[model samples]
Target chain A: MVSKTEETQLNRLENQVDNGGGGAWEYLCLVRKLKVRRSEKVLKHGLSILNDPKKRSALGPEEWTLYEQVAIAAMDCQCLDVAKDCIKVLQKKFPESKRVGRLEGMLLEAKGSWAEAEKAYSSLLEDNPLDQVIQKRRVAMAKAQGNISGAIECLNKYLEIFMADHDAWRELAEIYVSLQMYKQAAFCYEELILSQPTVPLYHLAYADVLYTLGGLENLQTAKKYYASTIDLTGGKNTRALLGICLCTSAIAQLSKGRNKEDKESPELQSLAATALEKDYKQRASDKLGLLTSALRSLKI
Target chain B: MGLGFIIGVFGVLILSHAAYSTIQYRGLLKIMEEEFSGPPMNVVLELLLGFVFCIWAALTVPGKFLSIHPDSEENRIVSLSANLDFMIFNHRAKAFPLEIDMKLKH
Candidate 1:
């Protein structure tokens, strides 16, 4: 529906905003709208506003929130000098603010001073133990220092207090996968699936973990979950199609010497194989010949 | 008969050398166990060095003098012809050269 000229004009406007040609407040709002606080454009516009004395005075007391936002954005963009200037201004205005203290800790984090950042975050937590941002930052500091187990511990504690945080669950799952603890990752995915059962990605991830575990029972469960993923995505997922093929083959291998009644039927294997071949032929463009030949070699 | 005798003698010589090295290794192990009263690491290092020497001797001594080479030009030509025969026997004739007869179907 969007014409080419309109798209070009939109891109030009975005570029202008990105280069700090847009007003500071508009730029901040735009970056916030995009949920991209760490962008270089945010940092540049934030600095321009805070540097000009006239523009600085024009921002009334209520707009002091902009200073904190700008400082954090600057820290995210690795502009420590601009961040420090903003921090000094905020600290002078409100010397006893705990939120300002959190920003100070984040500044230390930006400086690669992990221990000092930890100390700063700990003192802030002691003053106000229920601060979620401080808790998350502590977890982030542990992660940045490559203490994955420590990060996991902190995240578990945070999740105990805030059990519904999907982002925290996803992060814990990722850490478990990095450690090759697939069972624990599956548990995390299970929680995510329980909370949001309709999400295709959670089902896909859980199926992948079960497939990696690879027993007859786990493979059957993985196949069911992968089927659900395929159904949820309307059969567009190549990986789910491949997973179905693999699980069928693995089940066939496992049940080969078992009782005849326990074996997955030949008809089911043939159906999965044919479906996979059709989907691969239809979807796989660059590796069409290779994938088709590979499926053919599977002998299903 | 002379070539067979020479090959038999070389084989016996290699086998005897291998057996002697093995017996010497066992004797060294027994000696270390009974006489050496140093750290365990020294015994381990000695055993490791013995193993390395055994493998090195096995590789270098017997194979170097016993390999039969077919390095004449006639042998090389025979090998090349065999490979050419395999290619010709297995090759399938194409209907046309791939670069020609380009077709577009919609």
Candidate 2:
């Protein structure tokens, strides 16, 4: 039984479709989202409207964007033939469009003709060297081919042009970590922290990298960052609590013979360990026993 | 042929420098061991050997070089488009909806 809210939404959608409103495609997309298995119903409705001679002629130039949306929806529904038909219509309507060219390249990719797809994107880039989407696609292709360095190089070049892209920075940082380039990964996280300082994940990640690098100074910094992470998360982060405990012990060992006293006190390590034990018991009881054993092995 | 020779010379130069550094490190370790009972020489030797092999592998591996075939403007297009296709498909399932949403608003 459809609820009152769902029925109201469906009625609104029907009214929009009946009146030839601009939001018909959006309505169908919403329906597609609600019942994914009923996408064929939405596609058929869209196709019927497109097929009607009067309706086709009545649609404005901007409304023609619906064809691409319908094509993508058809693709999602595994109706390749329908998608191809829509793409053909779109191509005929906008023959010289780079946007259409991108869709064509996407179709080639979907068809598993990677080399041909690459050629299409390359030509598109040749026409406009600063095309950001095409540039990102090039990096994605290198990654798909398992060319890590190539992907890194492409991302580096793209960042040179668009340095403010945080998503790209995060991706580059992850790739650096995968390559075990902790210093480089640290630099990326530093960029992220500088841009958005309050995000606990960046602090946690930066701390992890510094800990892995393992110098007295780096470990000290790592401990500080982990503390910041815990504070930011309101002391609810088990990993950050564990990090404080581990860093305390490690720093104590590293500074044993050195002039510098241990920055992390034994009392602090005990307190963090106690908090971690209680939190793990509350959240992950099964891991609680293992955590105790691990702490024992560490002699913390 | 010229590129190969240059690569070969570069590899040799790097290997010689690495070897020189390893010998100097070993001597320093030996002196430290005599004065202060430093770490085991065998462990230090193994680490140095591993570092040298890593550098050698990186230098000699010609596969690291970009090997795009039929190197021409057309082929460059092929490579670039292939890259773009990769990016598109990779983010399609997740990011396409966001793209469409932005398009609809515009």
Candidate 3:
């Protein structure tokens, strides 16, 4: 029932493989097509092409394409057991392959076997310590298990590998915030703000952390963060809320500084810093209040 | 009472839907491999069937009774409607509410 053109195309694909033109991806695609067509002949041919040691030598890398193909085929056939077996075989053979390892993790995770999957991912890390996907999954599993320390460790490990990953940094900051590790969380948020200066939420979160930590010395930085956040968000009230925080921090710092210095206090520095912080806070609060009133009016 | 009943119905559906979809998703994967040429259509059909299965599962299985938990930011315990609650928790939850606490973080 196949059209001549289709047959010719399949033949061309075979020729491409024969001539060393087919890469790993091309072979995988052929195997997938074989599965789609339910052509065992084609599937076998595709496998042979993938398994050919000569092809592997030419292709430069032989990872988990064949294993993935078999797993997909097995899953398509409703052979969960076979799919499971294929996964095991793939895991054993291509232990370092990302796709195979991830699929194995997903299958275990799907079965509600979180502990086993976590263990597997941990073992996987022993081999590929810098695998971001494995690290992220480990964090996710740890978080799911409510192991905050474990999740933090996993995320930290991931951060070590991918220092510039803003999302990872933000997530780590969020986790630290939730854990009430205010100082650590503040630093993370600050780093994120430094990298993605345009994002208002990072500043807001950082300011919140500074307020929670209850240090007035950080008020100046908090104010800058809140101001920047507000500007980026079109001067929204989120900025204002954060601004109040900055005000409080400044007051706390000035009062503490005054008491610490006693008669020797730098009165000029204290007054200038406090006045600057108070002004910023008041402006933010007023704008935020206006937004709140507008929101209330809209609701009504 | 209406809220409780609606909640009960909703709980049942959520459980059934998850189970049914899992089964159908597995089934569709097999079908896709067996007949690869028209897999897109089959994939769509499987998704549609998955939706239907979810609805059916919601209607039949009393999800509230099972110790089912979803790991998400919002930890929603299985709060069943009064009617479904009667059927599911009457025996086990005589002294306490049939609530499954999902610990999102340790």
Candidate 4:
């Protein structure tokens, strides 16, 4: 993660490149390396280079990669003609590339010609059924056509083959959440947590799902996960702090008629509240009063 | 450059000076035809000081190693995932008049 200073520097470079300044090639490389989405700017700047004979040739062997990048970016920006043009160049350059073939299938999918796209993808898959990207495209195509169940089924199949893929798990979990299938979503999150326990996003998402389930046991588990999220993020995440307070309040409400020993502790809530207040004081002093009143309403 | 960098540079200069002084002292001893005693204590001190300064500079120049996956405001993960291969924000329906229907039962 870039600090504020580095982030500003990147923004400045983006603006300069956007205005047709130099470093367009360098900026595009940076975007790809960092996996940041800058499709509109990439389409514009990438076309500028591709459309120029001298500048395009100056890239030498890197020219084909630039073509692929522009093609993908153009597809994103709804410039099908530009995408077709770039893909045509790539196809001419490498006639038998499976990668280029995948691009063709993608272009057809983008054009909404489902039958032709299905045939293209099927033929490509026959060559290499282990292609992860093609399988994901199938799920994406199902989703694009508003077939959520089909998408989920495709994703589950993909997971059976590639269980280690975090993105597929995340997508499946999100689809299950949308369907309000909390148990399935929780299982997906469990898979995610098992795969990469350090990623705070999955922890936070799992906590949210458990909280939504809202049973006595689920709430207790949700509180633990939320605390783990806070620990993973070094206590800077405000939502996790609020989750602690909320879980404590709910536990208190549920435990009123229970034995004293069965009641959950509350000191963790007070500590979370203090940390939240300190964070607010440091970042938004004027909103401290509001935060105090909100915490007071939570009755901790 | 900060003070540590200046000290590093200074340390390099001193190391070079120590090497030069050793060369010059050897030349002098050969000219005077005297037995080469251990050259001078000052050269060893200069080498030690330069070593310390260079180490300090090496540690100070680049600063600390930060966590690249921070989810704070400065470096929040804007996109859910890269998921570039599956991005379906726009399609032929928006770009041009549709010739075929995608919503047809498959």
Span of 10 residues, lowest total lDDT, candidate 3 chain A:
A34-43
Write the residue-wise lDDT of candidate 4 on A1-300 in tens digits.
233444566688898986867998888887776656787777877887887888888999999999899888777766778888889889999999988998888888777798898899999899899999999988988888889999999999998999898888888898899999999999999999998776777888999999999988899999999998887677878888999899888877777687768545657899999999999999999999999998899883
Which runs of model 2 end up more than 4 angstroms from their true locations?
A1-97, A259-262, A265-267, B1-106
Clashing pairs in 4: A1-B68
Highest DockQ: give the candidate number: 4
Is candidate 2 or 4 superior in DockQ? Answer: 4
After superposing all C-alphas onto the true structure, candidate 1 shows an RMSD in angstroms of 32.6
Per-candidate DockQ versus the true complex?
0.00, 0.03, 0.01, 0.14
Clash pairs detected, candidate 1: none
**Candidate 1: chain B TM-score against the reference chain B:** 0.30
- Which residue runs of candidate 1 sit more than 4 Å off their true CA positions? A1-70, A89-95, A259-284, B1-106
Per-residue lDDT of model 1, residues A165-218, tens digit only? 776787788789989999999999999899867667778889999999989999
Best of the two (2, 3) by TM-score: 2
> Where does the lowest 10-residue lDDT sum fall in candidate 4 chain A?
A1-10
Model 4: share of native contacts present?
A: 0.22
Better of 1 and 2 by DockQ: 2
lDDT of 4 at A275: 98
Per-residue C-alpha lDDT of model 2 across residues A1-300, encoded as one tens digit per residue: 122345467668867776766566567655544432333445656776676667666776744676876675565554556777778888888899998887777667656577997999999999999988777777766776678999999999898889887767887898899999999999999998898675677788899999999998899999999988776666766788889888887887887788875354557677788998988899899998999998887663
TM-score of 4: 0.76
